[model samples]
Each structure stands twice: as C-alpha cells, then as structure tokens.
Target: MVIESLWFLIVGALMILMAIGRKFVERLPMTGAMVYLVVGFLLGPACAGLLTIDLQCDVALLRTLTEAGLIVSLFAIGMYLRIDLSNPLWRLTLRLAGPAMLITIGALFVAAYWGLGLAAGPALLLASVLAPTDPVLANELRVEEAGDDEPLRFALSSEGGLNDGAASPMVYIALALCGVHTLGSSNPWTFALAIAWGLASAAIIGWALGTGIVVLVTKLRTHYDHALGLEGFLALGLVALAYGATLIVDGYAFIAVFIAGVALRRQEMKATGEKPPNEVLESVERGQREEAAKDPELAHAYIAENMMGFSVEMERFVELGLMVIVGSVVSAHWQELLHWSVIWPVLFLFFVARPLGSSLSLVGSSMDRHQRALSGWLGLRGVSAFYYLLFSLEKAGSATVANLLPVIVAAIVLSVFLHGSSATILLDRYLSKR
Candidate 1:
C-alpha cells in the first residue's frame, strides 16, 4: 500500500513539474526523455526502491502501454507532414524509409548473427527491433509545425512515421525463425504471400479509414454543424478504427494508424483548398472557431489542427510515463547490459551499420554529404523498439527476449543521450548552412 501510494505521489509530482517547467526543460542540454529516464532509474530498486518492474512478469502490461504510445505518436507523425502527394520532396522520405531502412536491417542482422555469434532467429529479432527510428522521441527533430517541411525534418519525420510500420514484417520473419507462429510452420510461398498482404492491406485500410472519417465528419458538419468541438475524441476514434480494422485483417496496425493520419490530412487539405504556408499562421484560435467552422475549408483545417494538437499532447504524456518505465527496466538489468556482447553491437550499430545503410541508400540523391550524415546519425530509437521488444517477449518467450533485452536497452539509452543531445545543434547548423 505504501509503495502504491508512493508511486502515485511521485507520478503526480513529476506531472506537475512537467506541466510547469516544460519550457525551461526544453532549454536544457538534454531532453525530457533523459530527465524522465534518470528519475525512473532513481525510483527503481537500484536507488530509491520506490518502483520495481519485472520484465518477465509484466510483459503483457508493458506491451499494451507501449503499443498505445506508438499508435498515438504514429498518428501524430502522419498529421505533422502536410506536403502534397506529388511533391518531389518525398523522394528523400522514400529513400530513408524504404531502402535505407531495409539496408539497416540487413546490416544489423549480419553484425548480430556473425559478430555476436547469435542464432539467426535472435539476431534477426534484435535487428528488426532496433532498426526503425522512433517517432515519439524524435519530436525535437521532426517538423516544427504542420506546414514546415524542411527537407531534413520532413525526411526524418516521415521516415520515423513510415519505418515503424514498415519494419513489422521483418519482426514477424524473426519470430517465425524462433517457431513462435504459423509463418515458420508454413511454406515459403505462404510466408511471402502473408507478408505481402499485411503490407498492402495496412496501407489500403488505413488510407480508406482515414479519408472516410474526414469525409464523413465534414459532410455532417456541412449540413448540421455536427462533429464540432471534439476533434480529440474524433482523432482517437479514427486511430482506434484504423488500427482495429487493420488487425482484424492481420495487417500492420502501426502502418494503418500512420497512413490513416496521412490520408486524413490529405483529404483535409483538399477540403480546405489551402496550401501549407497559408495555414501556418491560422490556428484553431478561439476567436475564429465559429467563423472557421462555417466555412468548409476552414472547418477541415480547424479540425485537423485540433486533432494534431491533441495527438502531440498525448504523445508527450505517454513519453514521460514510458521513459520512466524504460529507465526502471534499465536499472534492474544494468548488470546484464554491461557486457562486451552488448557493447560491440551497439557501437557497430551506430557507427557502422546505420551509417553504411543510410549512406548507401541515399547515394545519388541531391542532399549534401553533411545532410546525409545527420540523417544517418538521427535514427532515434525509443518507444517503438520497446513495443517490439515486449511483443517479441510475448510471442518468442523469455529465451529470445533475454538475449535481446540487454542490447535493445543499451541502444536506446545511448540513443537517448547521444542523438537527443546533439540533434538540435546539428540540425540548427545544417539549417543555417542551407
């Protein structure tokens, strides 16, 4: 009872501090994730002993919480990108999310399988889990606002949004190698077909659901002024619908949620007939609420803005709580994480695997060497990796996760410090050069 109460008290205090000191915290050299992580470590048995997490026992609970965080953040990431569908700027995003991502996965798999002497199953799982850049923690480096599509920010932001979902099939492949599912039981044709369907269906379902909801809400509002004043609820409902529908068809929910956000934004932009720069200064401010709603274009923009705001707020809240949990997990397992097996892979990942994959994928693109280097370096890993870790634990059992947990935790810890600290400075310099 005392521990439970202490948990509430500590969480409450942290929330209050965050609410008040967010601006001040933003100015610090480190990020909010770093601060929350250290606080969580202090709360763990290694220090204050106020909180303890059993990775084996709490896998289900942690998976659900982390999954929810990813869903919300993925949706928000989708909405952040306001670029037109035909914009040539998307070439950078596609290269990063598509080829760059696959190359990173392949490179990490080789290092894990050969350098670390792990079995193929575990090696692949580790690679898949760590490959995607985290959308949740990369908030500092993503688009500043809806219309702000600076190439670097847009590419990283969209890549973060796209790759999490894109990486799911690889994770399933890894699980199959461990005999966790029917994929391993089936033939190669079956595996290939299933993966193809999962990818195709997620994109279709998410885009349909996203565009459908926007159209529905806009029509209702046009005739009856309905669906007003609760864009938050609407956003959550859309995420749930897209995610649930995708899972029903065995599609990737992360992709569905992200695509849903993108589709909805595209539809909203069409409704508003407004381009990026025009909407930058016009927010869903209180004074413009009624007038904005009366005009169809403004109405769509209004709801889109409100939904983006709600999603961003939810992403931040989830980040603090989840980072604390990650910190406690680290505190409990620091000993296991401090080994050569763990050290080499992390070094190889950041220095060798990621840079090689990113550089190779981006070759022949117009981005300068400096921009390309920053893109390679900024693959921030956070909640998305944990989601996969807990997910693999649930399916592949403790043996697989045991090998993976240490390396994943170490990578995330290093990323939180290394990428988080340098992203702002590097990005600022890059922009200045531009």
Candidate 2:
C-alpha cells in the first residue's frame, strides 16, 4: 500500500512537471530523460527511500503498462512518418537499419568475450538486447518535422522505427541461447515456432485492425455530421488493440506494436488515395507560408507548430514510466556496480558493441561521410534496451548473472540522459551544418 501510494505520487509529480516545463526541460542537454532518472533515484530506496518498486512482484502489471506505452509510442511514430518507401532514402534506411545493427551486435559480442570476459552465451545476450536505437529518444535530436518529407530526416526516422522490430529476432535468439525462458519452451524448435508464430500473428492482426480503422474513419468522414476526433482516439485505440492481441497470443508486444504501426500507416495511405491525411499536409503548408510571412522585425512562429505535440507528450509519458522502473530495479541491485563481471561488460556494450554494429550497418549505403559519421555517433541507447534487459534478467533468475543487470541498466540510463540531452545541440552543430 505504501509503495502504491508512492507510485501514484511520483507519476502525478512527473505529469505536472512535464506539462509545465516541457520546452524548458527538452532544451537542456540530456534534460528530459535525466530528470526522470534523477526523480527515480531520489524517490528510490537508495536515496530518500520514499519508493520501492519490485518488478518481480509487479511483473504482470509492469509488463502490461510498459507494453502498452511502447505500442502507443510506435503507433505515433508510424502516424508521423510521411516518407515514400520507394525512395532512395528507403535504401539508405535499409543499410542503416540492417548492417549497422549487425555490426553493433557482433562487436559487442567480441567486447563481451575479451573486455568483459563473459561466457559466449551471456555476452551474446547482452549484445543483442542493446542492439536497437530508441526512436522516441532519437527524435529529441535534430531531425525534420514529421511532415517535412526531407529524404535524410525521413531515413533517420524510418530507420529508427523499423530497426527496433528488426532487432527483436536477434534478442529472442540470444535469450534462447542464454537459457532465458521468457520466449517460451527450451527446445530450439519450440523457440523457432514461437518466434514464427509471434511474427505472423502480429502482422496478421496489425494489418486487419489497421485496415479496419482506416475504413471506419473514412466512412465517418463521408457520413457523419459531427466532428469525430478520429485521429486521437484511433491512435490510442489501435495501440491498445495491438498490445492486447499480442498479449493474448503470448507474443512479443513490442514487435506487435511496431507491426501494427507499419500496417496502420500503409492502410491509411491506401484508403486516403495513397496520400497522408490532408490535415498534416495542410499544417505543413501553413507552417511554410507562415515562415514566409515573417519579416526580420516580426517574431518567428515557434517551430513547435511543425511537430506533432500529442505524439511528443505520449513519448514523454513513456519516458517517465521507463525511468521510474529503471530506478526501482537498479536500486534493488545496487551491489552489482562493484563487480568486474558487471562493470566490464557494461562498458564493452556502450563503447564497443554499439559503435561496431552501427559502422557495419552503414557499409555499402549511399550516405555521405557526414551522414555515416552522424549515424554512428547518434546510436543513443534508451528505454528499449533497458526494457529488454530487465525482461531477460527476470527470466534468467541467476543471482550471479542478475547482479550484472544493474550495470547494463546504469549504462542505458547514462546513455539516454547524456546522449539524448546532447543530441539537439550536437546535431545542430554537426549534421545541420553538413
């Protein structure tokens, strides 16, 4: 009961701060995620001792909420992506998403073996879990607005969206090899079947549900007299449905959410005559016109108009939840930081695995020197890595291995706060100039 009340208070405070200080918070280097982590640490058992969260006891609830947040985040990402998949940028995204991820994982595995001195199983597991970049955090960097349609920006956005799902398979494989039971039975065939079933189920459900939502929205526009507010509700409902369906099938909810997002975007485009919603298009046009309307003496309209504020809000909520959870989990395992077994592997993942994966992924791609360099440098580790790490650790239940969990979580918190905070400034100074 004390814990529940603390949870409520923490969440309430976070919401208030986010509402009142969003722009100010995001402007600071690593400010958004940093604030969340700080709050978590303060309220956590290690500091003020006002909150104690146990995922082992609260696993069912935590999983459900985290999965829901992830789905909603992915859906918003899909809704905002206005890129044409047939473009040259799409090819660049493939290179970045595919090879870069592989290289990072391979390098991390080697680092784990040599630098961390971990056995092959655990090393590979750590590398795979941390492989994907978090789009929600990455967007905090310098990038075009959702409707900008700039090839480079679109490539970055789409790569972030698609790569997380792509990395899911590697994570599952690593877990199986590491003897983690979260993916289902221990048999290799059972694991393979579970993956295949999960992927197929998510795709099928996402397509059917996404198509239906698009059709229903179209009919509402054609037949109704009242303003439906379809976009807001549709976005929320689609995420809920996608998450619910994946849970029903015991599949990876993150993969299901991403597939749902991709399907929803594709279906919405098909329904709207192969174009994005005119609302977003008109908003972009208005932004451009207003920009032109400004004189040297007149105040410039804040570029905030160009962004999807609603999506940004949802992402902030997810960030809050993730930070609190990280704090609770890490505080419980604070002793791990002193161990070489833990410290060395965590260092290798950040310094070795991620960089190697990103470089490999960009090879043979059409990106210029600056773009490739930025891509490699901007591989910010955030919520997704933390989420997978905790999930895998819970399944493993090895105190020796579990002791290493906090070190990785600490690394992610470090990356998200430091990397996310500095992204905009760095991008403006480097990539934008290029």
Candidate 3:
C-alpha cells in the first residue's frame, strides 16, 4: 500500500536524522529518547486515522522489539558498571536495589489501591509494573565510562539495572493475585518459586556463563596476542548464552543478562595480570606505556568497549522502533486522558509515587539532602513498564485489564514528557553546581 511505503520512509528518515544529529542532541537539553518520542507524537494520528495498530496481529512483534531493547540496555548498563564488591558504593547499590525498590513498590501499591480504586490484582500489577525505573529510558541518567564514580548517576543506573529483575517476583505475585481474583484458583507455588528459585537460577547461570566467557577470552588473548580482534563480539555470545540458559529454566532472563554483564566486567577488571592502575602509575616508566599496550588487561578493556558499542547500537535501534510505535499508540488514545482516573494515576506516578518511594529507600544513607532529592526525582519510567503491561494483559487472557491499559499508557506519555524534558536541564544544572 502507498501508506505503508510512506510510513517506512518517514520512520527511516527520522532515524537517519537522529543518527546525524546525535552529537547536537547530546550537547543540548533534549535526549535521543526525547527526539523519538516527540516525533512519534507528531506521527501519531489523533483521530486514529493514519496508523492504528491491530494489537492482535502486531502484539508479538511489538513485544519482541521491546524485549530486545531491554536486553541490549541491560547488558550495556551492566558492562559499564565497575563492580567493586568491597566498595561502600556497592553497599549503596544493594541498599537501593533491595530496600529502595521495595519501598517504591509498596508506595505505588498504595497509590494504585486508594487513588485508582482497583482491587488487589490490578492494583498490585500496576504497582509492580511501574515501580522500577526503566534502563532503556534511563540510559542518559546512567554512567557511560568505567572509572566515573558520580554517586547519583551510579545509584540510579544500578537501581534501574537491578530492579527490572528485582520486580519480576512482584510481577508473579500480582499475576497470582489476578488468578485468585479472576479464576478463584489459588496457587502459592508460583510466587514462591518465582521469587526464590528464579532469582537463584539467574544469578547462578549468569555468573557461571559470563565468567566462563571472560576467562576463555582472557586465556586466548594471553596465549595468542594476535587474536585480540576476534574477541570483540564475545560479550554478545555471553549475553545470548546466559539469557537463553536462564530463560530455558524459567529463571529471570533480564536479571541474568545484567548479572552476566557485571560478571564479565568484573573479569575485565581483575584480568589485567598486573598491578592496579594507581599502583602501576607510581613505579611505571613513562616510556614503558607503549609496552603495556599489549597487556591482556588492556585487551580486556578494548574488548569490553567494542562489546559495549554493539549493545548500545542495538539498544538505540530497538528504542527508536518502539518509541515511534508508542507515540502512535499514545496519539490514537490521546483522548483517554479526559478521564479523571487516568489523570489521577499520571500525577501520582511522577509526583507522589516515584519521589516518595525513592526517598523512603534513602532513609539512613549518608547522602545529603540534595543528593537524596535527585535520587528520588530521577525515576524515569519507560519501555519495560509497557512490556510488563502487555505481558500481564496477554497472560490474564481476558479484558479485565483493558481499562487499566489506557491509564498506564497515559502515565507513560506523561513520563516521556516529564522525565525526558527534565533529565538534561535539571541533571546538567545540578551536576554543574556540584
């Protein structure tokens, strides 16, 4: 059809413009996520005339794209993180991942229950789905390099990175509740197994597979220096291996991918076969720097960089595709905002739920007031939350969640504007003064 060709042209052109102008956007107040979102908004037909998605037909494909986006983003986030187990910052990350995430979940449950007047199943589902910040959208809020130790950025990124899997248990819980409410069929094992064995399997598989690859790559490059270039794509293999193995057992693949990334990154740090950088600097000859270039440790860094580049490119491609579709969906449902219940949830999610939950998690931490506030303020939700919604809808196999979908979409639209617009200006200004 003529419309399909025009649609492809517009989408392709938009991606091209984003590619060329990436530098410009990076330096400005808006982000690449924002560009895709805004363009989607433009392309979205308010009257549902131009591009109405047939959810029944396209759901599988759409879900795959979003899942891919999350997969790539999670790996990238894990790769960039410096996994110092001994560091207090790691303590902070754990605290945030555990207590902070729970606090957000509980708080949002209240908002959904009282604010939306939903029963247990949908209320808990909304809370669980929306509680965690999305890594795909929170990339700008995260660290890009290995050595950078900015506290808020690290905390937010780690929280986003871990919480996707962290929230999976709750997703199972919510689904169980949905079963109880809808089918009057109660099974405690679903939630119990998902929380317990699922997490354990992800950790085990991810650690085993990821560390295995890193060790193999290190051995190969150490024995055969001429083969360094061959290891560039090893991270992809690690991701696929760990994720596939985890999912095969019904373990959390999202968590597995992230853990694999961390495992591999940790191997890189330790694989140097030399002194730590600080120690190396003291006794090293300035002229020997060239000699050190061939070291296996340096090779690890190079391999990690190439792997990160591949993941980032993949993440961006999936993100652009999904957001364009999201923009169209939001555009078609723009009038859904006229409902008071919809507006209520949007306001609560951004202003009340995220900040309150985030603050609750930071209760005893040494972070000062300003740092604490930024941590609360920067819970940017995107892609994965929508995926959760679609997943719940499909799993329930009914229209009970139909009404809730629009409200969640409305909240996401608000998030796209609220978080996207503020991420750059607010973060830049705040970090600049620091």
Model 3 is weakest, by summed lDDT over 10 consecutive residues, at: 273-282
Candidate 2 RMSD computed on C-alpha atoms after optimal superposition onto the true structure: 6.5
lDDT of 3 by residue, 1-434 (tens): 99989888987888789889988887876677777766776777864356666555677777776776787789888887775767667766777777777877787788788877888878888888888888888767888566457888888888888888888878777877777332222556555655677889999999888788777765666666444553436656777788889989888889999988888778767864333333333444667443343465465665665677788777878778777778777777777877888888767777776777677777788677788888877887789888887777777744657767777787677777778778888788888999
What range of 10 consecutive residues in model 1 has the weakest lDDT sum?
272-281
Q: How much is 285 displaced in model 1, in angstroms? A: 5.4
Arranged by TM-score with the best first, the candidates are 1, 3, 2
lDDT for each residue of candidate 2 in 1-434, tens digit (9 for 90 to 100): 98788778868878887789988876676566677777777777888777678766675667556656666667666656645556577676677678878888788778776776777777777777777777766666424544456545666676666677767777767666666555655777877788788777776777677656555554544455222333455567766787688779876556566666656555544434443354434444544544322321111111112223455567777877777767666666666656666666656655666656656666676766666666666676766676666566566655434644666776676677657766677766764575
User: For residues 1-434, could you state the per-residue lDDT of candidate 1 as single tens digits?
Assistant: 98788878888999899889889877766789998999988988889877799988999999999998899999999998888989866898889888898888999999988888889999999999999999999978999888686888888999999999899988998888887885333678888888888889999999999998888887777678777678889999999999999999888789999999999889777866656634642665678686676566576777788788999999999999999999998889888888988988988889988888889988998777887898899889889998999999999899777878899999999899999998877877788888
Best by lDDT: 1
Winner on lDDT (2 vs 3): 3
Model 2 ranges off by over 4 Å:
1-14, 150-152, 180-201, 224-227, 246-253, 267-311, 332-335, 338-343, 399-401
Model 2: how far residue 184 lies from native, Å: 8.9
In model 1, the clashing pairs are none
